[model samples]
Target: MEQGLALLLALSLGLLQPGHGQPLHVEPPEPEVAMAVGASLQFTCSLACAGGAARVRWRGLDIGLGAVLSEAGSSVLSVHNASLSATGTRVCEGSCGDRRFQRTVKLLVYAFPDQLAVSPATLVPGRNQEVACTAHSVSPTDTLSFSLLLGNRELEGVQALGREEKEEDLQETEDLLFRVTQRWLLPPLGTPAPPTLHCQATMRLPGLELSHRRALPVLHSQTSLERPDPTSSEPPTTTSPQATPQQGSTGTPRTDSSTRTCRPEIHWSLEPVSWELLCEAACGPGMTVHWTLAPGGLAAYKRREAGAQAWLSLPPDGSRTEGFFQCRLDPGGQVVSLYVPIQKVIPKT
Candidate 1:
């Protein structure tokens, strides 16, 4: 009992402080932190006791491209745009009252694209057009997968484009960036079909699952053509073989030059209180725009502009909602959609 009382007295007298090899009570107490490339990173190291004023310094940040701010009893290390090369161990040292302490943090970094890029959002019926989808940069290739979907059918996307690398991005890291791509020959669009194509990217982090999806409008392009007979006046064209594609089986569908030129784009903006997602798709004269959620639920408040452009306005809760905000255009056959994925992350220790 006397020994316990003596220890209490020592603590009350401020005679004890963090010693060498001990932690300095860092703000982000997690043993490690995982951040996306170009993300903002900040952490603090602090020490306080009766052993004079505390001073802290950070080590192992030469490649981090960050700055350190030291205060009376604390120090903060902040990196505005974290580089992939900066991922590694970071150390913080604190000293006070002739006593010194140290702590270490592990930083994990990843590269994931914001959008699931799809090519040829719209297409003419009858042409065997090659469709492709791509994700720009990805690291830790084994943890990521891409699925190309047509209606309910799913196909795996290949890393056909291979790796796009830089000398400085990896330095001595085991994970490197890669460009994933896949292509397919558009199949014949049977009548009354939902011929939509989707490119979905899925990433499995330590304890988080991230997904991004983009869809293409119905672009069926398979048809047969035959010369019209001028010799017989009694409807010679009706005797030809019936066309079965969306453009009809009798002949090739006439395609508009404007439809081929129109591009699909999604402009996303996040503000303090609310966020917006705008889709600029080319819907020609026969197509119309529709908005819905992928899992079959009420979508965010939306408005369509100029018959081809659509906007989705989320609630003013200042929190990002997770799911796919879809914008689609068709003549009402339930086809072609562009997905805007809003992610919500609950970091795991």
Candidate 2:
């Protein structure tokens, strides 16, 4: 009877020990978790035992950040407004009967910028000015960069002035606020249209990156025009008449005095031209030459490179030429020539 009581007591003592026959299991068996800044993360710890109900509590081991713990049925730890400093180890403890259980998990957080902004929304034209851009609420501030864009073109020579960091106290936690500023000198504007400016902010890490962009309000400026000089005197020129031979019955020029003088003007230009020297090619990735003269007449076309001596004759079909071209028209023994230089097309990166 004594041996039987001892055996029963030993068995009861073993049963009273927590996790004696059952183990503690934590969800997300992987020990580490990664989360983005300003995001939320949750960790659940559960206990399974042949014994009775267990008491559970969650705690952070490596960091002092506060997390929400739910212990009604299962223990859960929830972290909000995660930041780079929030990375650490978390522990969950459970007690059942006279035994204790614990589990550990690791956390990792990534930092990124929140937004981009431009100061002095409107930029004035034709004035030497400076424009400022800011990257707001960025983490890992040293990795943040700012760029400026006018219309769709990226502005060159933009410089980063400086950066500052401030400590912000939130309702639940404290955060580091980083602001980066960049400046660019605005060129004089000659167009009446308002220029659009874009501020771009980028944050880069080993394997993570974030970007944000914001556009400034339309720029306004006063355009100055040159006034005419009233002290200058010049004579206005008059157009002369051109002689047109009277047509006979057979549509031939008559040699009589009835012939009259008629004036006809000739001008030359490219079909499509712009102030810029750059032009799109007519063929595959090459430069094309085009020259045309107004008032269709007997004309000839020739082309040659700037350094080349020989000029190549072009067919009258108005086909694309490879180099600089010139069109000549002979009317009344007066010859007129129009030259057009072909600009090479540059490939964009």
Candidate 3:
């Protein structure tokens, strides 16, 4: 009778409990996610088990980020408009028989990028081209600024504005969404034809728990003005390595701890067979002007290194037929560069 009871108990337990050795599986295929602000993001939790009905649960739905859709054997967490508040790890769980499983999907929200786009692929000297930079689909237009530079000199009056600034019939939301456009008119370039025109867009986000990412968002774009070959410098060539200027007075006064600018006085005297070009940068005597030939190699420096005043004799023969003479000054190891034309050398006929 006892043996019969034990057999009956065993049968009952078998009928009540699920089959052993099959574990519940819960996972998200791609847990790491990045989405633009106001975009849609969704993830479904995977669940597997044997011999029992599977069920699922979505967590973090109460955070006001989005809604969760529960289906047969799986559940999906979705953010229809992913904002900064939606950037975090979203959790989902599932159960099969007595087994439970958990999975998390991380999401990130971003704005103020893609990249900075600048129009007019190349800039030419003496041409007043309107240069425009766009911070595509950025949020929070206020406090965002752009800076425009032509060969390291900041051009003024670049204003950062978004669609909301011009569209009078736009609705306001928690975060304003629009493309930022900043424009600056390229001045008649007097420095060099091949000026490095650089544009940068910078935006500061609020310091919050937006995925623990507090770093600022910035975008950059640049194009060089194709410099025409100097009437004296050679053909297209590689740029010379930047020479470390010394602290002594070399050409001009210090513009700052880092830069020095000079308006060099250039003239040439007559030699028998060749004309001698003389350029003076008055940082005082004992100052060696760091002469450089830009957009080409220094074999064009005329190898004629001099003090305060530097001279490069011209036959236009064994040397360059055309190139710009960049007069550089060093004060505190900062080299300021300015290109001068041979027009300064009025050879009196």
124-214 per-residue lDDT for model 2 (tens digits): 4555556666665556666677777666667654444555455444455456655556776666655674445577777765455667777
> Model 2: runs farther than 4 Å from truth?
1-38, 43-84, 89-115, 151-153, 162-173, 189-194, 205-208, 218-349
Clashing pairs in 3: 230-323, 231-322, 232-322, 232-323, 233-322, 233-323
Q: Which ten residues in a row have the lowest lDDT in candidate 3?
A: 211-220
* Best by the lDDT measure: 1
For TM-score, the strongest prediction is 1
lDDT of 1 by residue, 1-349 (tens): 9999986776566454334445488867787777888799788888785747777877776424447877877888886777677777878877777556678888777788674556553433443555666665676566677666665567433234432333225455454677666666665544554545566778887546787777655523321111211111121111112222121112222233764533334456554444565655554575555554332233434454556566666434434433234444455322223333344423222
* Model 3 per-residue lDDT tens digits across residues 223-251: 11122222211222222232222222233
Compute each candidate's TM-score over C-alphas: 0.43, 0.37, 0.34
- The TM-score ranking, best first, is 1, 2, 3
Write the candidate numbers in order of decreasing lDDT: 1, 3, 2
* Cα-lDDT of candidate 2: 0.47
Clashes of each: 7, 5, 6
* Model 1 misplacement above 4 A: 1-23, 63-66, 96-100, 118-133, 140-142, 148-177, 182-197, 206-208, 216-349
Q: Give the C-alpha miss distance for residue 320 in model 3, angstroms.
A: 41
